[model samples]
Target chain A: MSKNNSRKIKQSVFIILMLTPAIVGFFVFYIYVNFKSVVMAFSFEKGGETFYGLDNFIRFFKEFTLPDTMFKDTILNTLKSFLSTIVIVYPVSLIMCYFIYKKIVGYRFFRCLFYIPAIIMPTVSAVLFKYIISMEGPIDVFLMRFFGRNVPDFLQDGSLAMGTIIFYSVYFSFGGNILYFGGAMNGISQEVIESATLDGCGWVRELISIVIPMIWPTFSTLLLTASVGIFTASGPVLLFTQGGFNTYTISYWIYEQMLENNNLEFASAVGLSCSVIGFPIVMLIKWGLNKIGDKVGA
Target chain B: MKGSKIKRSISQRVVFAVVFVLFCIYAITLIYPYIFAFNAALKESGRVFTRDMVSLAKPARWKNFVDVFGEFVVSDSGYFKMTWNSVWYSFGGTMVKLITVTLSSYVVCKYRFKGRNLIYNTLIFTMVLPIVGSGPAMYKLLSDINFIESPMMIFTFAGGLMDLMLFAYFKSIPWEYAEAAFIDGAGHFKVFYKIMLPQAMPAISVIFIMTVVSCWNDYSAPILYMNEKYPTLASGLYSFHERIRYSHKHPIFFAGALFAILPPLAIFIAFQNSIMDKVFLGGLKG
Candidate 1:
């Protein structure tokens, strides 16, 4: 074999070797674990019997358990979280990036400061906020002093708890949106703006006609991502609530039911139900967006 | 003309200055909590609880740092070997991710391989699936196969496939660049290692930093897999916090969390611009 052929063999072998751990782990751990979860979902634990078939799933569907309430809450929280991301986070990010892109002075400092939250670990953020939202924390203390009123327990209150979690979801992801929007803004050429100005277009007109249109593809991508995340968003609730409150999401519910509750079979049934629910909702949203996108293109 | 130009420039400066100031206030609010956590970490136990919540302590308690480090249990003779273990896992896990993702993404995005579209869509769909829904099925599988305890769990089974990050970056690279290398008689590996890898450095760096930071700070996986022997920084923070839950709540726990998060935070500040640039621009151009 020539030197090139030998090099090719070595590289291929190394790449294959590098990939071996992951491939083996995926099959053994992920594929096998899930397959067993399916089996266990049908049967009860502790007896070690095989091929019970559909009983666990039937129990899940039939029983009015805590997991059922949790399932409903999870779906609601997921939808609420998505709406919050879309309505608040995305628009705010676009506007903030617009200001920064226009170099609205001291942009560098502002940009750096806004981006800090993105880099912090989610667990740390949750713990920090735990202190911040405490009765004696600055914000609550101030509220106690200023209005002569007690600051409500943000985490424990069932009605307000979901909203509080959703609020952090937006805050945690806000930095990423700024970065994406800023990049999109930067992609708009100066020449296009100048030409639009020469054509007697106002600043607003230029932005709407040129900037928005130019970044439509990025918008489409973010929209799809935002929608998909609605079905599966996990961070704030996981780190903050630990799915403790009535605010337990589908994901957390599955986790608790499987691991903590030791209803391995029931958890798998719920997991399957979630996948069944989420997959179609996601597909429908995408189909709708694509239809709108195609019409816009047309 | 000069007078009008001067007025326009002045107005522009004023507008920019106002935006800057408003944004500063917003940034400060977001930053204040973390900065307070840092300060809380440095405060002595007494000062942490009794000191005015808003005021800085007179003499900082640096011993909180020592307490966190002391929690790491190395066998008979080894000290800080746990940290070394974490470092190994992070690096090993990231290496696994980089190789699999790069190859998988390359085949899908670049090569006209069979089952390409099916693979791509499935991966993306899986990526978006909620962690809770997947956890039960995944945990049972890992446990049954005796993978729960292994370090390999970090890279392959647990966390994520990271296909989205790799796919977004892979799709962005122009076909022409890869084609040019092929035309020059570069084999696939040669093109990947030398040409494609170099071009995709920004994406690689982003993924590398993210993987390392995530692995370092991860709490759940270590709690699940390592059990007692090797806990990552996040789990360590949780353990430390739980140990001294009452009196040391303010400073010591905050200190541990701060110390746990610092390495990643420092990296973030140092490479902030590059990270942001890669996140948006690198994936959007193509």
Candidate 2:
């Protein structure tokens, strides 16, 4: 073969060799697993026999429509978790990041302190938090001493369990948003900020008008990613409540099905149903965000 | 603007003071738990429940750390074995992912090949298209293939966030270097492995540390796939906690929790700057 032909062959070989692992991984782990999930969703297991149909999906839908079903409850809990992240966690994190960006007193210390949770194992944090808020734990003791009232079992009380989980979720997310938004804000031109300040832009106005718009791309990306993870919006459920106390989220319910119940088909049905319902909504949200991003020149 | 040069209005100063106080309170909340854990871990196991948890440990039981090695056993794996498992699991998985991402990203970013765009688009598409609840299917597939409890399960992480980050990293590096290496009689493999790969080391190392930290702390995978035989520190700690939940071995469990966090904590402290800066950049750019 000629030299050019040999190089072409070599290049082709190189590309194939490089791409093989990723391709195999994609096919087996992503494509094959998803395909199996779809197939499993449409199938049911009989006594030592496998039957393919819509039995699992039909059962899922039937249960999902029923009032007070675990399916409906878990879905609602997941939605609540997602919205809490968007409405409460995101804004709180943003405001905190703004103050940190402004070089608030002890900003460096606060920045590192906030990031501690992100680095620590979620299991460890959950375990510690569980004890800290337990009936006779620090919070309880403080409440009793100061308020002359007994503290409720935060994680055990059905009314307070989900709220506690949401609180944990919000606390855990602060470090990450601080890092991301802080970095984004760091990238903002100092000259522009100085100009805003010279224009008499106060803290709130600067955060609303100048800082937010400048970091819009990062904010939007985080928002989009959070939306993409809507179905998986869960705290450390296994460590905290084990899906008890009416705090089950969709992801935990799916995990429970697989790990505890050993019901792969039903789990797949639920998962596929989520994807079917969630995909279009996510797409529309992405489209809407993109449109807004364009308008805002993000 | 210099700190001294920028003048804050009265309202801005007031806002700053309020924000500062709020941050201080939040900081205390963040720090208080770890302090409690430290004090609680040093207390006698029985006293942890009986005594004031807010106070310092009386007659500090430093042996709790040593005792955890003996007490905190999950699936017949002790503390040292679990730590070893954590090391191999995190490093092994991270190396596999890094190699896969680096190799594929270098090839796709540099070489003019058919299906290159297809591969790129596929990576991005799969990333953006969230596939929730495939855990059951994944578990089944792995079990069927007998990959469960096997180290070979690391290959499943071959394509993920690192792929896009490294793809972007490699794209920025000029192909002229590769051409020069080829002209100097270096083969394609030599050009990639010797010339281009070294240049991508900084990006790879950042991702490597991040992935290692994540993998080290990842309990779910080991809990599900490693079976009861091989428990990493995180998974072992988890199961250990469950085992002692009713027994009220709070001190021993807290000691184990503290032990499990040290490695990752050390890593974060060491790479605080790189992690804080690069991770966000990777996310934004990807």
In model 1, the clashing pairs are A33-B141, A41-A265, A104-B16, A105-B16, A251-B132
Query: Every model's Cα RMSD, please?
Result: 4.8, 2.0
Task: Kindly provide the TM-score of model 2 when superposed on the true structure, using C-alpha atoms.
Answer: 0.95
Chain A TM-score (model 2): 0.95
Please give the TM-score that candidate 1 achieves against the real structure: 0.83
**lDDT score, candidate 2:** 0.81
> Total clashing residue pairs per candidate?
5, 0
**Candidate 2 residue spans exceeding 4 A from truth:** B1-5, B47-52, B159-162
Candidate 1 lDDT over B189-257, as tens digits, reads 777778777877888788788778777767666655664566555655555544454445557567666
TM-score of chain B of each: 0.75, 0.91
Off by more than 4 A, model 1: A1-40, A43-48, A64-70, A258-261, B1-21, B46-52, B71-82, B107-132, B157-191, B243-249
lDDT string for model 1 (A164-238, tens) is 888877776767777877777777877787787777776556666776667766776787776666655655565
Q: lDDT for every model?
A: 0.66, 0.81
Error of 1 at B266 (Å): 2.2
Candidate 1: residue A149 Cα off by (Å): 3.4
Ten-residue stretch with the least lDDT total in model 2 chain B:
B277-286
